[model samples]
Target: MAVIYLVPPVSYTCPNNTTCCDDPTFDTSVFKRTIATEFHLICDKSWLQSFFQTLFQSGVMAGSLMFGIASDRYGRRPAVIVAVMLELCTGIIAAFMTGYWSFTFVRMITGAATGGIMVVTFVLLMEFIGTDKRSMFSAIFHVPFAMGHMSLPLFAYFYRDYVQFQFAISVANVIVLIYICLLPESPRWLLAMNKVNEVVTILTKVAIINKMPTDTIRQAVEQYHINYHVSSIPKGSVADLFRTSNLRRNIVVMSFTWFACSFSFFGMAQYVSYLTGDIFLNVFASGAVCFCACLVAIPMLTFMKRKKAVAICNATCGVCLLIIAFIPDGILGMVFACLGMLLNFLVFIIIYLYCTEMFPTVVRNAALGFSSMMARVGSMIAPFVVALKPHGQWCAPVLFGVLPLISAVLCLMLPETKDIRLMTTLEEGEAIGQSSRKIGTK
Candidate 1:
C-alpha cells in the first residue's frame, strides 16, 4: 500500500500528429488500492490532491470560530462532545466515500470538528488546573499528541489499505467520546456562570478524591463567588478581542505568530517526501524530535520567562531552517533539518502556554480560536508554498525561515506572562500589558 502511493506512474510518449495523447496509468500490480489510483488523482488531476488538503484547513478555520463562540455561550463539555461526535461521524463516512468530492467534503467536516476539539480541550485543561501547575500540565499535554503522531506510521504500515487506515484512526474518537462523558465540567466556567453550588459540589468531590478537607474547598468557592460579584466582570464576546487598542495590538501580533508557527511547522511536515527519499524514516525522525522537545519544554517553561524562551527558540528555528536551505543533500542536511523542526516544536509548546496565560478568562477561548483560525490560514497555504519548490527549491525554505524570524522579533513586542495571574476582565488584561510595556521601556 505504501509502495502504491510513493511510486510514480509510468510515462508514455505520444505519436507525432496524433489527435489523442497518451494517458498515464499507474502500475497497480504490486498494490491495487489507494485514494490516488481509485480516483485517478494522478497526472492531470494532481492539483486536486492539493485542493483536497486545503479544504480541510478551511473547514478548521471556520469551525474554530463557530465552536469557540459556542463554548463561550454554552459550556466547554457540551461543545467538546458535539465536536467529537461530528469528527467521529465524518471520519467514518469519509472512509467509505467513493467519490472525490464527497471525500473532500467529509474531510472538511472532520477538520472543523478537530479544530473545535483541539481548542476546547486545551482551554478545559488550563481551566481545571492551578495556575502554578499550568506550565507543567501544558508541557505534559503534548505527550499524547506526540504519541499519536508516532503511532500513525505504524498504523499505516500494518493496515496497508487506505480505508482500513481511515477506519482505524476514526475509531479512536469513539474512545475519546466515551471518556469525555465521564469527565466533570470545568469549575472555573461554573464560577464564571455564577453557579456557586455546582462549583462547590465539584470542588468538594475533587478535594475528597485527593483526601483533602471538603470545608476548605467550600470556603474557597464562597470566596470566589464574593470576588466574582465584586469584580462584576461581564461576559465577553469575540468582538471584545479587537475593541481596544492594546487588545487589538495583541491580537494582530499573536495572530501573526500563530501563522508563522503553523506555516513553518506544516510546511516542513508536508514537504518531507521532497526533502528526503526515505519518507517513512523522515516522518518517524520528525515525530521523535517533536517528542523530545516536549520533554525539554517542561523544564524550560518551569524556569524561563515565556516571552524570552519563545523568542530564542523561534530565532534558533529560523536560523536552522535557513541553514538547511544551503546544506547539500546528505546525512548532515537531514540532521540540520531535524534540529530546525525540533526547535520549532519547542516554540510551539511555549507559545500555546504563553497565549493561554496572556488572555483574560472571559475571552481566552475566543482569542485562542481566532489565533488558531489565523494558523489554519498558514497551514492552508503551506502546501501551495511548498509546491513552488519545483520552480525554485530555495523559495519554500526561505519563506519558512523568514516568517519565524519575523515572528521572533515580534515576540519582544508582547508582554511576559511568567508568574502572572490569569486576567478575568478585558480592562485587567489591558492594564497588565500596559504595565509590562512601561516596565520594559524603563
Candidate 2:
C-alpha cells in the first residue's frame, strides 16, 4: 500500500514564502528522496503514478491466487514461509533499485507475497478456532493488521528517506521469520487432507498448550474421525468451487462483497490526501480510527448474525458516503468520511469470517484467494475513479457510495453462518451456504 501511494515529485509552492520547486532540480533537502524523486515520477511522467499503483495491486492479485492454491496443494506453513522470505527479499531489493521499472517490478512481487501472507494466514487461523470462538479470534487477528497501518506513519515520520523506510519495515520481517519453527499447520486442514497421524500429533500439542488433558483430546479426535468415516471426505480444488450451483452462487456473491469493500476503502483512502490537515497526522489518525473500529467489532460480531451485520453496516456506510459526496471538504465531510471508513472496515471483518464459514475446508483457501483477487481488481480501478474527481467533485464518492448499497442487497443472497460448524465436506458446505434459517437454528 505504501508502494502504491509514493509521493510523486511535483512542483508546488512553499507555505513560508510561496517559493516554487522547479521540475529538473528536485530539492531533496526539503522533499527528501522518494521513488518519485529518485525516478523522476512527475510532470509528463506523473501519469505513471497511478498506473504503478494498479500494477502493484495486480501483483497482490496474482499472489493471492498463486499462494492460495499452493497452500492447499502443499501446506500452510511452507507457503507462508515462502511468502515471508519473498517479502523480505523484495523489500531489500527495492531499497537499492536505481531504475523505476526494476523498483516497480520488485514491489509488485512484494505485494504478491503480502497478499499470500494475508490470505493463507487468515484461513489457517480460522481453521484452528471453534465455532463459538471464531468471532473473537477473527476480530482480534486483524488488530495487528491495523497496527501495521498505524506503524507506517510512525516509521515514515522518522525515516524520511525511502531507503531507510524500506529497511525499517523489511527488518521487521526477520522477527516474523523466527516464528517459522514455532508455527503449526492447521489440524483441520491436515485431517481434511487425510493426514490423520500428523493432525493427531498437532492436536496433542494444542491440548498441552491449552493445559487440557492430551489423551482425552486425542481420543476424542480419533473416535470422532472413526465414527464419521473421515476418509470419505474428498479433497476440493478450484474446479470444485463451481461443481455445485449453491457454491458457485456463494463464491460469486462473496467475491462481489470483497470487491466492493476494497473499492470503497481505497476510494476513501485517496481522499486522505485532499483532507485539510498535516499529512502525517491525518494518516496516523486514520489508522487509529480503524484500530478502534477493530475493538468495536469484537462485541458487534458476537451480538449480530454475520450476514445481517454486514448488510446493515454496508448500507449505513453507503449513506454516509453519499452525504460526503454532496458536501464540501471540511469538518463535516471529514467526519462522514471517517464514519464511512469505520463501517466499511467493520463489514470487512464480518464478510471475511462469513466467507470462511460458507466454504468447505479443502477449497477454503482457494475460494478466499479468488475473492481476494476480485478485491484487488476493485482496488486497481479505484485510482481511475478517484481521478474522475476533476470532471465532477462528487464522481468518486458517488460511485464508491453506490457500490456498497448494491453489495448490501447482494448480501441477502448469502446464507447466514453465525454459529454453524466449519464444513469439512463439500456436501455440507453446499447445504449450509445455500440454506437460510432462523437465528436460533444451528
Q: What tens digits encode model 1's per-residue C-alpha lDDT throughout 20-55?
A: 243545555433456665676654676675676688
For each candidate, the alpha-carbon lDDT, in order, equals 0.78, 0.81
RMSD of 1: 3.7
- Native-to-model Cα distance after best TM-score fit, residue 45 in candidate 1, in Å: 2.4
Worst lDDT 10-window in candidate 1: 1-10
RMSD of every candidate to native, in Å, equals 3.7, 3.1
What pairs collide in candidate 1? none
Each prediction's TM-score versus the true structure:
0.92, 0.93
